[model samples]
Target: MERKWTFLTSHLTSLNASTRPLNGQTAIVTGASRGIGAAIAVGLARAGAHVVVNYRQNAEMAESVAAICRRHDVRVLTVQADVSNAADVSRLVETTSAHFGAPSILVNNAGVAHTGLLLDMTEEEWDSIMTANLKAPFLCTKAVLPHMIARQYGRIINLSSIWGLAGGSCEVAYSASKGGVIALTKALAKEMGLSGITVNAVAPGAIQTDMLGHLSDEDLAMLAEETPVGRLGTAEDVANAVQFLALPSSSFVTGQVLSPNGGYIT
Candidate 1:
């Protein structure tokens, strides 16, 4: 039998969404049209959060993700924005606020992945990777800080990469950006600790997502075998981590890199 995205499926239908952990809070999940981002959004919703599904493109897919969230009986909003663009991020947050008051949970999951040699990588490519992966986090974090600061409560979860810790051979730019994200997570956690906002990073190892579209079946199998768990991670696997970080129970867990890479790297 084939596996499916059970987190977003009727499996969650059995849970008591109203009494879930994040009830009544608002969460904004960027790049949530599909894959890990989508999973995180749905997971947050299932936890009873009013979710804003942020997507750069793919309006239809964003709506589909939103529709699933609604099944959990939580409020759902879909906003289209290029988070790397500060103006667009401004609108994204503003729209989320206009509808759901202020977002207490922010999952900075919007990122672009690149796998190529340093010699072959162009300046434009490097900039795009940095802009999307690094700058977007900076922009979104900056935009949401004021509201969170005033309320003295917030959860900021960044989606990093396993390569960010153990650099990938042909993935210089991507590794660099994700490394920056890890650094950002630690530093921001320190800065926000006094303000009741906890910042953390989730570095997922070889998840079975569209991000791995370039890899062949053999390559995926090899990666799975290499993983101690003997299988690749799932978007829900990472989403489960994000959900924990987003909860009030994780208030004391800050400035940490919660890598869900199945022990791919220690």
Candidate 2:
């Protein structure tokens, strides 16, 4: 008998119109043209938040994600900006504010990964990874923080990796960057808690995204076997965690690191 497979997007229906938790809010999801970022944008829109889909280079892909968000009957805006650049981040934030309003939710989902021996990695390569994975979050948070603080409300979610918790063998730089994200999430959570803003990080295990394109079929199978859930994670799995963190009821849950790794490292 053929086994049926469950997808991440399939869980969206579980949160219907009656349960729209983010009504009247605006959310910004960086690197949202594809994969985990796109899924989060859709999830937030489904929860009734106007979504700003921020992408670096792919306008067409961003438009596609925006179309999906529009289906949820929430406002959708697509902005092209490199999250790591301060000026670009400023423009992205200002555009969101002007078009929608101060974004109450920010998802720092833009990141880059490098796989190689630490010794073989060049300074430029390491910097690129750090800038995208670590610095981008810092820049985006700084841009949106003032508004959140002024309003005494906000939710910020950073995308971390399982490697950040348990360092990977060949992905030293990526691991370091994500670990920094986790630390930033915790420290910022403490700092922002008094202002009614919550900060959290979602660390996803191996997921079916372009990030895994470098892996072979055998490698993927081996990873699945290592996971207790008997399968790789999905973008939607991570998105669900992000949605929970973005909800107003979760205001009390701050500075937490939620990993959707399917028990891969716990």
Candidate 3:
């Protein structure tokens, strides 16, 4: 017997609705100027959450994303801060708090990707990726935990990578940092459990974003063909995972790695 499946892209539904499940909540997304971060920001907005779009630079792009989110009628604010720095992170949280009360959801999606030999990588480069990918989540999570604990409810979804699950060649630093994210999610999930906060990680695999710009068409085709889904995943695909984690309905699913990798690594 042969079985086949069809995915209807055109049939996808919008995340926005006045009565959507996230109504009255607020979400903060880092690295949201473009790429997966942008998609997640809008998706959270569509679900009726007042959103904070956080970007280090690229104000123009961040504002553009904010404009789109505004169409959903949710309160949207664009904040510029380098998530890897502690002082900047504090200010970012404070600014969000001033405008939206307190963030109920935090998406730690700001990260850089590196590819090179471990020996060839400079110490600065290694530290840069680690700070952005791993430490920022630590700081962001720590900053938001107090309020979430006080309210006894929070959703923290960290953006990890499939490379974190299966190491990548020529991407040693990136892989190591994402793996640390997984560790952070697990440990924090345990720590925040009784406090009514859930910490989880979303590891997208070979998503079709600017991150794949370095790949040639042929290379991308090969990568897509290698996946069981026969295609590269979209930024929206990853956002779907984040959305699920952000929902109040997902309260029981904590300390988990939800990888939307098209079954490439599985």
Candidate 4:
């Protein structure tokens, strides 16, 4: 007999009270203007962490996410910076520190995806994808690590993908970049463990985000049917996982990749 899959909502009752688990902490979420990044920002705010919503080109959308976070009664700030650039990463970290002190949590959610056959991909395209999806994490983590190490406490969560674990056809660049993210998480976790910092990754599968806009109705329906849960994942599904990993109590967990894929790849 085939086993049935349970939706994430079915496990909601197992969660603890809505009380703040991250009070007085500050978190920085990169590329938080929309989609999964935006969801993670709001989720962190609701948990009582001051949030710095980082965006590269969409100021309006970044502010919109900030407004949602503000409604949670937690402090919210919006910053614009190209995470892949060293100077910009420095500016982002400095501004956050000036306003909210050094961040206790850094969510490297900023990333770009490209879907195409390797034969058709250009060098510029591959470079851009790698810089955004992989280099940004390295730069941001470097900028934040000093503060975290000094404080002896921090949470660094990288947004990875199912493709990182299992390669995707026609998405070679994207797969390789996310795979680098997973590798970075593991190495950094070990390096930072002695300093009381935990590093981890959240890999989402076929989420209902703007990223799926390119897919046709039939394509989406086919993907849903393929998933054992009979549905696609959600930004909130990934957000919930980030929230858990960000908690102070999760100190024992490190170098882990939590995939909210709805049984799509497991």
| Poorest 10 consecutive residues by lDDT, candidate 4 | 1-10
User: In candidate 4, which residue pairs clash?
Assistant: none
TM-score of 4: 0.93
lDDT of 2: 0.94
Give the poorly placed runs of model 3, Cα more than 4 Å off. 1-19
Give a tens-digit lDDT track for model 2, residues 3-54: 3234434455445434888988999999999999999999999899999999
Runs with alpha carbons beyond 4 Å of true place in candidate 1: 1-19
Q: Count of backbone clashes for each model?
A: 0, 0, 1, 0
Model 2: how far residue 66 lies from native, Å: 0.2
When 1 and 2 are scored with lDDT, the better candidate is: 2
- In model 4, state the lDDT of residue 160: 97
Give the Å shift of residue 187 in candidate 3: 0.4
Instruction: List the candidates' TM-scores in order.
Output: 0.93, 0.93, 0.93, 0.93
Q: lDDT by residue for model 3 over 71-98, one digit each (tens)?
A: 9999999999998889999999999999
Predicted candidate 4 versus true structure: per-residue lDDT over 137-205, tens digit per residue: 999999999999999999999999999999999999999999999999999999998999999999999
lDDT of 4: 0.95
lDDT of each: 0.94, 0.94, 0.93, 0.95
